[model samples]
Each structure stands twice: as C-alpha cells, then as structure tokens.
Target: MLFDTLKVSIVLVTAVTRWKGLETRFLLWKSLPSSIDRLQHFASSRMCASVKRCDLKVESPGFWDALGNLEDGGLDVVKKFFELLTSFPNLATLSLTALTLDPLKLQRVSEIHTLQTLIIHDCRLPRTFNKLSIRDLEVSGNPTEMFPASKEDYGLASFFDLNQVERLQVSKPTWGDPLGLFCTQSNSPISFSNMKVLSMPWTLSLSPTFPSLLTQCPVLEELRLFSQAPKTPSHSKFNQSGATTLHPSVAPHLKIFIGPDVCASTFTSRSLRTLVMASSEGRPHDIRKDVLPILTDIAFPGDLERLAFGVDCLSDPLLDYIAGSFKSLKNLSIFISMVDGERYSSDIHCRKMWISRLSSRLPSTLIRFDISTRFAGLNHSEDVSGEDLNVLMTPLSQRCKKLTAFTMSYQSAARGRTWAWRRSERTGYGSGQWVNTDEGVRQ
Candidate 1:
C-alpha cells in the first residue's frame, strides 16, 4: 500500500510539472529516509534543474539511528547525500534545522560555488569545514547549550572565520560573557570587513563590551537589537547615564538603528538617518515620562529622514518636541492606544485635533505620515462618522503641500479599518480616495 501511494504521488507530481512546463525552484522536506529517497530521485531528474533554494529539517532521533544502520556508520551515506545536493548548479540558498553537520560531508557540499545564503538553526557545526563563499549566514542556537557560561567557545568562532560573510544574525545566546566572543582581545579580533548589517539579541545588547564591539565594524550600515518581551507588565528601566557611547571612529558609516530608547547624548553618529524606538508587547501604557527624557537628549542629525515612536510615547508635548527637532524628517509613524472611558474619549478628541493641525505643526519636508490607533471598546460609543474623516483630511490636503502619502488606521477587538490618502502633483488638491467596507469615496 505504501509503495502504491508513493508511485501515485510521484506520477502526479511528474504529470503536473510536465504538463505546465514548470520546474521546481524551491523545496522543503521534514522527514529523513522516507523523503530522502524521493528527494534524491527528484534531484537527479531533469525537472530539478531550476531548483535554487532548499530547506531540510531533521529533528527525529530515529532518523539518525536509521543512518547508523547504513554501512561505514552512516558517514558514507551522509557524504553521498551532500554529493547529490551540490550537483544542482543553480542552488543558491540552503537552510538546515536540527541536523548535525559533518565536517567531511560539509566539505563536499562547500564545492557548490554558486551558494550565497546559508541558514542553520539548532544544529551542531564541525570544528572546521571548507570555507564557504556564501555572502549571508545566519546561526541560531541556545546560548547556554552552544557556549560555556565561563569560557570562549571556539565552536562558535569557526563560523565567523569566513571572510565572505556580509550579514550575520546571532540570536538567543546565553547572557553570560558572550560579548567576549566578538571582542578583539584574542588574535587581533576578527574583522568583519564586508559586514553591512548586524542583528544581535537583546540580552547581548546589555553587555558592557557592546560599544567596543561596534567600533570594530567600521562599515556597518544597519544595527538591529531584538528585545524579548518581559514576563511582567512593568516596563524595563534604563538609566540615562548608563547608555553606551559610540565613538566617531567606530561604525562611522552606520545610518539605521532599531532598538530600545538610548540617551541621545550617548550617540555621536552624524550619519544616522533613521531611528526606531522599539516597544515591548503587553507593556503598560502611558510611560511617557520614561521616554521623554531620552527623546529630548538625543542630538538627532539635521538630515534625519525617518523617526518612529512607541504606542504610549506620542503625547502632545512629545509631538511638539519632534516637530521642532527633525526639520528634514520625511517619514513619521506614531502609534496611539486608546481605551474606552470619558477621559480616554476626551483625550482621543484632543489627539484628533492635534493630528488635523499636523500640516501646520509638522516639518515642511514631510512626504509620508502614518498614524495608527488601537481602540479598546470598553464602553458604548458611536462609530467614527464621515464628518470626522473630513475634519482630519481637509487641513492635511490644503496645508501640507509636499505630502504625497498619508495613512490612518484603527483597530478594535470587533473590527478594523484603514484609510489611505494620496495626492498627485498634477491634480493637486482634488485627488484623494477613501476606502471602507461597502463604501468608497473619490474626490
């Protein structure tokens, strides 16, 4: 019965691809021995010539035991598997999950010169493999299991030795002294000369050596710090004085930063063009005081083009401060959280008035504006009316002449809606559209 099912499946796939004149460009498989035979047969067939990306995930212990049953303790079986994989001339991206990498087998796979991106998750790497020519590499593992809490792990170092790696993401490493692995203290630190983007997990950002490590990536253009949500509702506190100060000598070309609020005074990067202040999910609202000082202290560049704020930080006073601070700002996104109550409703009305006056209050150079609101429907209230929409759109159209794109969106537990307004240079004020369920307006 299993043999008949396999034959039918193969025949169906063959018929569909042949009939449509299509070639498989991507493939993902989750099981070993069972899928392995099919994968081998497919790769050897003429239809696989177009395959350029492949993902293989092996998490079952039985699969490894199956390999053990093969001759030469499964090493030859692994080698032959990779030998077939590298035969695909066009394969450029490969991802593996929970599969132990054999150095000898990887050496054979590394012969594929066209490979550009390699991603490995929760896998063990051999101490050394043939240097890959890939330009992008991502490695993720549990830090506690991957690296010893006290000593530097050379197992981690082997992957960084590839000079061709231009982008790197290290996530979920155990917090104890992992930054030391990137420091130059040993063997004149590894220089990622071609690295243009680097993303580190949040726990690593709190390390004292973080600033020093940034200094090493002279050409790094973008930095992203991914923070985990706290277990409690209380927000994390950052001392204004304890922020890391970046010297001009390091990462001089850095232009984009996305992470937690840092004391603006601590940053000296004149080339900064974009700043994103990340917010934790499920955090308490109205923590404006915690973020206000950071915004006020940051010496934002005159040419800063984009700025984003967390949901609870866009108070009236902060908006005024931003309007005055970033004269060259072109894109702005603000998130507001509104709850149902008399006081909250009044606050929303005041914010609506403030938003209507953005044409006069915001930077003249602005080209795009995005405002999103999360409405908590705790009390009975009227649905947003057409008149309210007109009040918000008219001033923006008349006053903000350079504005080209505008978006306003609202989300509630019951329903969600979005409005997009665009102005063309030729038609001027008369060109705009409102989109809603069963309702559409053109002006």
Candidate 2:
C-alpha cells in the first residue's frame, strides 16, 4: 500500500558519495525556515496504509547533511513529524543523520515502538526516556554528549540503549563502550550477547583490538571490515599493534569474514563458509604467500560456499588453492589490478593470459562469476574498452558451464560501462546484456 504513495514519505535515495558535492546531495533539505516546508511538501501526499521503513534527517543551525538538512527549524516540526510518523503500523527502520537532538526530541523518538533498526550518523546525543527496541543498528559517527546538559544530568540514563541490537554496523567503537551506544554508565565493558553480525570499517582504531572486540561479540557469526580503499588501509592500527591473527575460541561461531587479512589461520572457526577478503596490498608481491597459507590453514575442505577475493595479483597457486579447497563454492568474484606493481597484468590484461586458466580452475558448482580490474583514480591505467569484454569473458563462459550470470567490470569516473551475461530469458542458460553502473564512480 505504501508503494502507491512512495514520494509522500520516501526520499528517492540516490548514491550520496557519487553525487557532485554536499549541495547536490541535500538539495531537498538545505536549511532552516524552508526545511519544514520542504518536508511538509515531501510528505504532503495523502497518507499511505502501512510503511515499513522511515528515514529522517535533522540537525542544528550550523549543520548540513547529504540527503537533506533540517537546521534551525526548531523541535516543533520534528515533534510534529514524528507524531504522524509513529502512528504508522509497520515502521521497521529509522535512519537519522547529522541530528542535534535535545532530550525532548529524543523522548519523542523513543515513543516509536515499532523501530527495529536505528542508524545514527554524526549526531549529538540526547538521552532518551525509553529503552530502544532496535535489533539492528548502524552508526557512522559519534552521538557525542549533547549541548545544554545540566550539571547533574551527566549521570542520567546512558546515551542510548543498544544492548538489544543483534546486528551492529559501527565505524568506531571509541574504547570498549561500542561508541557509548550501550546503556551502561558504569566502567564495566559491555557484552554484545545477542550479536550475530558485526561490520566495521578499516578505520576503526578507537580502542581495543579485534580479540577484545570479539570477546564482547562472543557469538558474532559474520565479521565485515569493508573499506573504501581496496589496497592495504593506512590506518590498520588494530592488526599492526598485536591482533594480527585470531584464535579459534575468540569468535568460535564465526562463519563469514569479509575484510582484510586478519588471518583465521591459527586453527579455524572450523566451519568458515564464506571468506571474502580484500588483500592488504601492503606487500603486493605476496599474493601466493599471504592468502593461500591462511586459506590452507583455516577453510575446511569443500566447506567454503562463496568466496570473493581482491588481490594484488591473480596467481596459479591462489586459483589452484581455491579450486582444491572450495569444491562447493557457488558464487565467486575476483578483482585484480594488473599494473606491474599494482598486481596482475595491466588493465586486467584484456589479453588472454589468466582468463583461460581462471575459467578452467573455477569450481563447477559456481552459479555467478564476476571478474574485473578495479583501479582507483582512473590514472596511470592501460585501460580496456567495452568492446573488449566479450574477448575477455568468453573463455570463462565456455569453461564454466554452471555460470548463469557473469559480470566483467571496467568502471571509472567517466567510462561508466559494465558488461555481463545472464541466462537467456527464453533458453534459461545462455544470454545477457550490458548495463551502465549507477552514478559514475568518478561523478
């Protein structure tokens, strides 16, 4: 039912990162006075029956955010909007960015009993009157202690109650407090007792090592350490200081790891099913030495069902290791940079070399395969054109019979082209087409 009145409440979300600048992204919510009018205009549409997700952004006088801005408009508008918002029957997600809420507004937000996911970014804190019922949370910035705090209010309820969140995505944990999202004012460390999925960016150097964090997220099943940089992250202080390798008992139930080379090699989580690693090209020459040893040590024979690797170079030993180890693998993506020092051959070599061997070595059970040369900066690149895709991916299609979808990407700021093949609609096995990537990576 909400689909019929999408624009009334939905912000036609676009890729903020790729947008021209802050001005372009927040065109809808630029500043005060007009802020409420813009929102009223956006939500002025006739009410819908049931909405599943709600995304709102608000901030102080000096504030500006991506999707829109709600600055200096006062709390009255926010209060009025949430009043109408909380009446919705099935609201499940609330993403608030750059908000500078005081206690009254925080109490108003706490009244939304149906919220299951809360995403807060670059916000100043305002302690809430009610405990949060969110099971999933994503925080990109600190909900720093807010302004206008009474001298004695520092001892009030914890900034927000995150103990109920089972799936947490964090940017920095700021010591062991999980960015003070946990509702504890004491000096004791918080336990993420119900946590199953934890994702952190490579820049998380707030406090504690991976082991210490894992101790809190004892039952964490999926660990994601994604980052904007494909090469070794410059701020990898966690692994540099001592948490270089994980002990099996730390994240004992860990089944999926998607990030840098914090080796699972010691013994294993014993049942690691999906390992998607972006090689720390701190040492570009050791594609064989660094990755294979860990794969050889931890991943059980025939256990890995999906594997995606971003490597300095694609090597025989690595491909051979994958073929030998992940017999049941169903989906695979390999990103290689062919610059001499960057990794494999230049420009994913639009020539023959590894294409033939990669095709032959990939497991028969794989349903989808993606291979590409993803270099940042669009510079010093010996590039390939879209016309070269067939010559590049044809060998793969011929060899891997089970591949229902195949994608080969050569994306840059300007080119904006992406090529792929999917099972033909008529035959259900051998047809597909090219598509343009949304918002050019360079834009």
Which candidate wins on TM-score?
2
RMSD of each: 10.0, 8.0
By TM-score, how accurate is candidate 1?
A: 0.68
Q: Would you list the C-alpha lDDT of every candidate in the order shown?
A: 0.57, 0.57
Instruction: Pull out the clashing pairs in model 2.
Output: 29-69, 312-343, 338-345, 413-442, 424-431
TM-scores of all models? 0.68, 0.72
Q: Among all windows of ten consecutive residues in candidate 2, which has the lowest summed lDDT?
A: 4-13
Q: Which residue ranges in model 1 land beyond 4 Å of their true spot?
A: 1-49, 59-81, 130-133, 144-153, 180-188, 229-249, 263-265, 279-302, 311-328, 337-349, 364-367, 374-378, 382-387, 397-443
lDDT of 2 at 55: 66
Scored against the true structure, residue 424 in model 1 reaches a CA lDDT of 64
Model 1, 254: alpha-carbon shift in Å?
1.0
lDDT of each residue in 77-139, candidate 2, tens digit only? 455566566555566777765566566666666777777787776665544455555688777
C-alpha lDDT of residue 338 in model 2: 43
lDDT of 2: 0.57
